[model samples]
Target: MRIFVIDSDPSFQGATVNVTVLPYEPYWDETVEGNTTRYSGVNYNLLATLCQALNFTFRRIPTREWDEVAHLVEIRKSFMTTVIYGVLPERLQRWDFTFIFEHAGLYFAMPTPVIRPSWLSFYYPLGGYVWLAILVSTLAVCIALIQVMVNEDMEKVKNAMCTEQMQ
Candidate 1:
């Protein structure tokens, strides 16, 4: 991908190219140990590879905020950023972008499956039929209970009729 089209010359002759760094996981990760700062990941690795190819050293201009990187690069304060910025029409008018290094997609991570005992796990494999049977049985039991309750009410009426017949 054309990271930057060097019209005059591709080689920097060991000159340092300034780059803006933002910590984006998997793309770029910034680690600071004492006074020295280190960067790793795909984007950082890409920048390092480019630097080696073009015979130029790179200096990272670290920034916490994202907007600052765009502003710095826009105003010519920095050469380019290693952070993966999406190419939009508005942004395209202001800056140049390399070919798409990453694609957009959704990824879902499933939780680790729990180990189950063979005896208990066998019950889990039962299909929807078991659930259907349980539901039907439950409904049948509820209907039976309502009928029994209604019969109890009829018993009171039967007792009153019996007392009237006795009188």
Candidate 2:
């Protein structure tokens, strides 16, 4: 909301704002081709938006280090900076930070889903009932085979005993 309360501060109007940055890639990065220094990234893009919102023009300091930016702000050579520095004691003595622009949190990237064509794929998605039925049927067949084998063995033993009695 309130980036800086420059409403009462006359030094803000049309101020040649010296912005120091850390060149955080995807946030701010300098791409130089011969004599031209072209800036791009999120912070670089934010520059135009911030200037328009505050009604002031800005120029970026060439330095990329955090300490150098702090020193520039300390000496009042720069109006402000574009770099996002952590709130540290040494830096605090030099410059005052405005409202927090961002809050860091856990970040994760998900992998792409695997694609495959198979007959089993259709059955795999079936609920527990299908698998349970398959398991129960297999078990029943196994028990029936065991019972048949035991009965056959018992009949062979009875026939051997009857032949022994006749002899």
Candidate 3:
């Protein structure tokens, strides 16, 4: 049997990078075991895997809130962060993102809307004065039509009386 040796890369030299961690459940969880702080979850696992594969180490940056985590990364207080931030357009402009390995779905729900009767749409746009105007106009037209019909009937009666006298 032959003996083999593996050598570490000189580029990384096991440099420690600063990483900010927030205890987001399912993605990140920070636990205290005895005196040492232990982190476990999907995000942390990914970070650990990257460090191991790249031959580099990372130091945890302490933060209290989600905003602080982003602030630390934004202000260069940390080299990176271990959390799943939504990839927004503004965020993409400021930072580089890795390929998406996981997805979380968001849904918006509201109470069912109250539906008014469809016929009510006709009156919705009109106010009290406008509706009164329409009613008056319609009645005026009907009265005018009745007057014209009555005048025509009187003219026929007069013509008949004149014809009978001529006979």
Provide the lowest-lDDT 10-residue window in model 1. Answer: 1-10
Candidate number with the higher TM-score (2 or 3): 3
The true-versus-predicted C-alpha distance at residue 54 of model 3, in Å, is 1.1
TM-score of 3: 0.55
lDDT of 1 by residue, 94-151 (tens): 8788777876666699989889898868667677899789889999999999999999
lDDT of 1: 0.85
lDDT of each: 0.85, 0.78, 0.86
Candidate 3 per-residue C-alpha lDDT over 1-167 given as tens digits, one digit per residue, 9 for 90 to 100? 99976665534568999999887888888789899988889998899898888878899888999888888998998989867777889989987888677775777999886676899877876899999999999999999999999999999999999999999
Which residues of candidate 3, in runs, are more than 4 Å off? 1-11, 108-167
* Clash count per candidate: 0, 0, 0
Question: What order do candidates take by TM-score, descending?
Answer: 3, 1, 2
lDDT of 2 at 37: 84
What does candidate 2's lDDT look like per residue over 1-167, in tens digits?
66865456443567778877888787888888999888898777778777777778878777757678778877888767776666668867766777567666667999886675788687667789988998999999999999999999999999999999999
